[model samples]
Target: MAGMMRRSLDAFCITFWITVFLAAISSATPIEPRSNAIQELWSSVRTLVFPPTNRCKVYPGDPEWPSDDVWMKLNKATDNRLLVKPQPQASVCYSGPFYNAEKCAEITPVWGSSYTHIHDPIEMMSPVAQGMTCLPPNVFDSHNCSRGGFPMYVINATEPKHVQLGVDFARKTGVRLVVKNTGHDFLGKSGGKDSLSIWTHHFKQIDYIEKFEDKKLGYSGPAFKAGVGVQAFEIYKAAHEKGRTVVGGEGETVGIFGGYIQGGGHSPLTSLYGTGADQVLSFDVVTADGKFVTANSTSHPDLFWAMRGGGGSTFGVATSVTVKAHPEMTTTASRFSFTSKDIGNETFWAGVRTYVDYFIPNADAGTYAYFLLLPNVATGIFTFSMSPFFAPNKTLEQTQTLLQPWFTRLNDLGITFDPNITQFDSYYEAWRSSFPLEVVEKINATTGSRMFPRANFETEAKREELYQNLRKSSENNRVQVHFNIKAVDPANADNAVNPAWRPNILFAQQAVRWPVNATAAQILKIRQDFQTGDMQRWRDISPGAGSYLAEADRLEPNFGQAFWGTKYARLLRLKTKWDPQDVFFATTSVGSERWKVESVDGLPNENGKLCRVR
Candidate 1:
């Protein structure tokens, strides 16, 4: 029986390989390079230019899928694939994962037309064909910024074969491939000039679950595995529905494996369980060569270690993540606010700062809060925007006592607030409202997650300097800079996801929304505003501080220092090895064309050749 089982598995893998190869070629039909003399040059820009979407396509049948025809299967899938309506002309060609196929191709000639219709690649397709262009005017602006660059058809993938096919082609073709989980990267990594984008949004599959009683990780966790598209909020909700719970982000739309986990996911529950990465049990990924592989403590240990917090550049396409689960417990969430009168008073701001410094670290490791700072320039009124959440179940009084110091200080400033607290039926219920799981599904036709961990969340001394600077800048009108820090727990030591993000423990976000395409005057106004109020506020801590990838602003230079922070070097080394040829790249990637491009550990470059460590 064992021999037979092995044979069966081997046969399925072989068949899967053959099918993907055929599908990859067939899908190129609609967008094959013209029989022009520029075929060679065009190939270099293959992923960048859309292959004319006019040609015959084909595919073969496989037993597992039952209908091994590539072109045919994809045609069938498109009909079933959900296409969101009410799309605007500007938005369809200039934004995120387009919900349809044809439009996706028109915008991303290389990835869309060439890679689309390929059975395995587009099976989980999440095409975002509509968005801004490289042309001019407001053409480059996206929702909050002025550039998402040229759109890349994110070939949303799910099954290992799907990822395997896309990556294999990238390695063979030398086409610049931009990989995206949820198109949520603030750095605009998932798309770039003449880039072929592969989307992992459609990679939503939950294969296994472990009850806390079983402890599949051997005392390390109440662990289970899921696809890359399984979001933090979705995981929380799923666990809650099953009467279980896990710690993760507090947002509704954040993807679990996209940027948040890649950086280090955090939430109110982190105080108790730790960051989402800390809880991973193992990870299964499809490498650049089309191999379906696993990374865990016992297998591919070094790669496993690196994936947790090293960042995404070192590894290939990761499809699913296995995470640790904890016992579900009760919890409390509370909200408090302050008015303009209290905010305008410097003494009040100082008192609030003093209390926050004292209370933040003193709050039980399980308790967490982030003050949302907003300034109403029209009134010269500043108000305290605070959002707090915690779990392991606490009463209103208990939660209030932890927050009382700051609460009282606000009253001293003429700020008073009513506390809102409710007992959640389960952690998932709380998770749903807090994180909004379905938001990912709503925002884009597809979904995925990412992580961005920073060594320094922030210090109270830093906060004081920030407010002081802002006070002076207030006279100049530049206080729109967003600064924030939220507490996070460590990831489970045994998680089996990508190896790049294993060491992160906290998450931070900072944003400056001036103008999408601020004119020279507008740009100057924003800069002047920050120079006085925003920039000076946090300038003291600026040297070592990092910014969030998703809340990207173009002004920052050497993004590696400002975003990846401490672990930048490790990511570089891994990137050097995996992408020795720099095949998978974009303007915002860790190892950009400008990087030294050295061999790993100072080894001599193998001249485009690399050895597999895992």
Candidate 2:
């Protein structure tokens, strides 16, 4: 029986690689036809001799897994920058040889902040994606420590050559590959079980260009070339220092060039300028074939389009990206809060409806509002908190005038809430003071989000329906709403961003968390109820709308349509052409549907081996 099973696996591997080789050849550029064909043929034969068990990627304990000597060669090839046998960040908190009570105590206090995880080579911000293997001692009882879903080894990449070497090693050895930059990914795309990781957090070089000329794209403007590891605040401050600004994210720690821009980043500046992806000019990447290339409008246009908004870690590993920078301008910002304690549920929800009603006008005025709705039935408390509302290039009186209608409605409803508005001379000053430091590291919660299109608010009836659906969804989950809308330029509309986003007015995200010690069945129930039950309310009202890929549900159904919409088919084709060997794997990334991560005990995690399912 064992011999027969082995024969079957061998046959399947050969056939699979043969198909892959043919597909790759058809898409291979004429310049590298001979070399590409030879490489594909060699890879296919290698797979036939050492077939992956269950058609999965190579994992530890497998005969095909690299030997110590082989890893040493990789380490030397990359100037001894390879981190062998990397461990999880919280491993020291567990009862193990690596445990140190003092160090664990220090880590525990800052575990919730993204700053702590961003510095670690292998740590991810979300513990749920980390497979909940090891957490701070205070969060749970000290248990066995394991690497869990993190990569087995990491190349502390500081340059494009290091990324190329890592990509080549993973491809040749058939080991799963993942890229990590700042470890701010919400979908756990940065980590994978038994994978080789390229840690790009050290690529912190940023160069400012006073005049960036791209004749092919018919543009010449001020721009910045930022390394993949450059964070939001860093670029914002740098651009401000040069008397310019660029589209960026709300979270100060979010990487500007990696997943943030690649996932169609939305921001306070989105209303005035555009999405973060729209500001991109070009990307320098290491392709799957281990070649370093620059992808721009004139060179590798398809790859450039896919990388702009197709989602990251799919086509290639980007070393740096150049983005357009706009002139810095004055801004108006505000913060206010009201709760059910101040009013009744009906009036509170009514106030929320008034706020939703103004999303279109506010977006038209080039304003962005980030707010939260927290409803706790058990405590009989509901809160609406707008940490800050940003109105770029607008004065204090102008912003107040734009929001007067909503305030009038609130006054009519007898809702008294202070609109603590303030004006700043520069966008950086307002941004630094307005947006609060985001609290991360939610181990027990799973998140789902949707982008609500403008058509949903075309009529009063439709608007009411949207409000009621949101109110119902908020009853069981906290809802975060960002009023960001923009119409894509015809010249830049060919990218892979969801069509729903162009006509969208709101991006809302909701999270559902389970108890720390919940049973497997209980956790499964929470996830199912949230995705299919609570989130479905938002989905039903906004038919044909899409969700934000960066902050979307992990188990979103029909994710191809939900994340990329009409652009999914083209994105898939581009993914196939560039990464024919499927060298890169991230959860729900482009082409990820072809692979499956087997879970343990109903939890959604990357702890298991990744197998080719299609």
Candidate 3:
């Protein structure tokens, strides 16, 4: 009787809860489709199963399309800063009622301006927008380029809350998320079709700390916090005013906190200090879970390590970054140029090898040369142009003394060249005059890079092989070589930059371009020339060395090993932990191997869905 009484109590408890649940469900507005058995069963437990919020995202032409209610809610989330992508330039070119030559001519100078402009709607820096079928139209074509490869909507994010809102929206609703700041992405990562973009260009917050404290790293120093929209020139100006400088990019308009530093930023000061990623102290970011937090040595340390050099738009959206700063210093600037017409190809390359041989000594003496090695100027002429070199904390006399050997060697080889050297009062002035606005031009080229170690210049045979391979590749094309020997010890800092950069003296790159009217077959050949054909030449030289993913081939084999070296595994693990659902995706980035972009009509484009591979 006692056991029966206990069983009756248990049954009574269950029945009581069921009656209460049913009463609650009946009182509340019922979910439709109660006629279905499964729906009825789920309705009873809907309160516990689903949250009281809408997580549905509608595609174009869907039954529940983007209705007015949807737009109203999205606009409220971002405080009415949401925007629909437009094509004002397309209207100026071929979409107007009648073509306006005056407007078209007016926009030519500004064509390249949109590449770095934070507010530009264009997806590509190049005039010929790749991966688009209608873009780069012919002069006689009737139609203009539409928003084929650009984002469907953009949130002009100005604060951490804005980023969090966008992240939450994209996460709750299964939509692709991309970040755009200045639109300076080399791999076209700033744009994606049928996606929602977080335009962080308005998140411009800069702060300086004279005595920084980090209990995790156990060090403190002078540092600056630059927002996501902070460009190179802006940071330089601010640092100069503070009587200090920071390691950054050469492009004046490139965002300092975006893919530049995330991809192991190299600079003229690399030999003296280190790469930009090395100087980072912390980052304030919004993760895939829609939480804004700080990542540093002590807080979210794994995210900090991965974010330093693991490439951007893969883990989360960065709101701002704090990096170390250095005191201002004077520098000796030199500009030199010579032609192969003065010396034939065989002798010219021999002279080139001799010049390259001095990279170690120059780097040791605190000199970094920003030069270009062009094998062909026209029909049979090659050019070696070191437009402006930096000799930090050196006087005019010391600068000339350092360059005297190079001059003497050129004189001995009968190579007539102009050596234009000067001294600057500050590094800012030197960088300003040396690396100008890059002379904006309409270019449609993809590039592949290789980091050549200092050992390549040690032996005559190695140098000969390097020069021979470069000459053969540039026989009918152009390959530009940048010689900046990074002699700093990366072991001092823990980050994810390519290991190959630690022992490299030069960064060599080869690129190919195609016309707007080029056939699909021709475009494929151009891409293959860089990814497979030209890359093999450099691979033969540095079999173990890796390339910079910021300017590397998209078709690179074993890209994880090439980009991250031994850190690939750790990075992949952290990527999974941080973004298990793949909220962020950039081509060739970590964990991107799991997804493959859709191909359209035998051509690859972002319009199609990014389907999972495995």
In order of appearance, the predictions have TM-scores of: 0.65, 0.92, 0.86
What is the C-alpha lDDT profile of model 3 across 470-530, one tens digit per residue? Answer: 7776774756757566747544778888888888887787766667567667776777766
| Runs with alpha carbons beyond 4 Å of true place in candidate 2 | 1-54, 479-481, 487-492
Could you give me the TM-score of model 3 versus the true structure?
A: 0.86
Model 1 has a clash total of 81
Quick one: best lDDT, which candidate?
A: 2
lDDT of 2 by residue, 1-614 (tens): 99999999979887886676455434533323335433433343343223333488888787777777677767766768999978777778877788888888888888888888778888887778768777786775537777778889999998787787788777766788989988777778888887899999888999999899987766798999999999988999999999998899888988889988998888888877778888888999998887889999899999999998998889999999999999888899989999988688889888889887888888878888888888786777788888788888999999999989999999899999899999999999999999977666577787888888888887888889988887876776554555545544435545777777788888888888788889879988889888888788889888999888888778888888999998999999999999977888788888888898886655778777888886
Q: Which ranges in model 1 have alpha carbons more than 4 Å from their true place?
A: 1-154, 211-219, 342-344, 347-351, 362-364, 389-392, 434-463, 466-510, 515-517, 520-539, 542-555, 561-566, 586-588, 593-614
Q: Give the distance in Å from residue 414's predicted Cα in candidate 3 to where it truly belongs.
A: 1.5
Model 2 error, position 221 (Å): 0.8
Which of the predicted structures, 1 or 2, would earn the higher lDDT when compared with the native? 2
**What local distance difference test score does each model get?**
0.46, 0.82, 0.72
Residue 330 in model 3: shift from native, Å?
Answer: 0.4
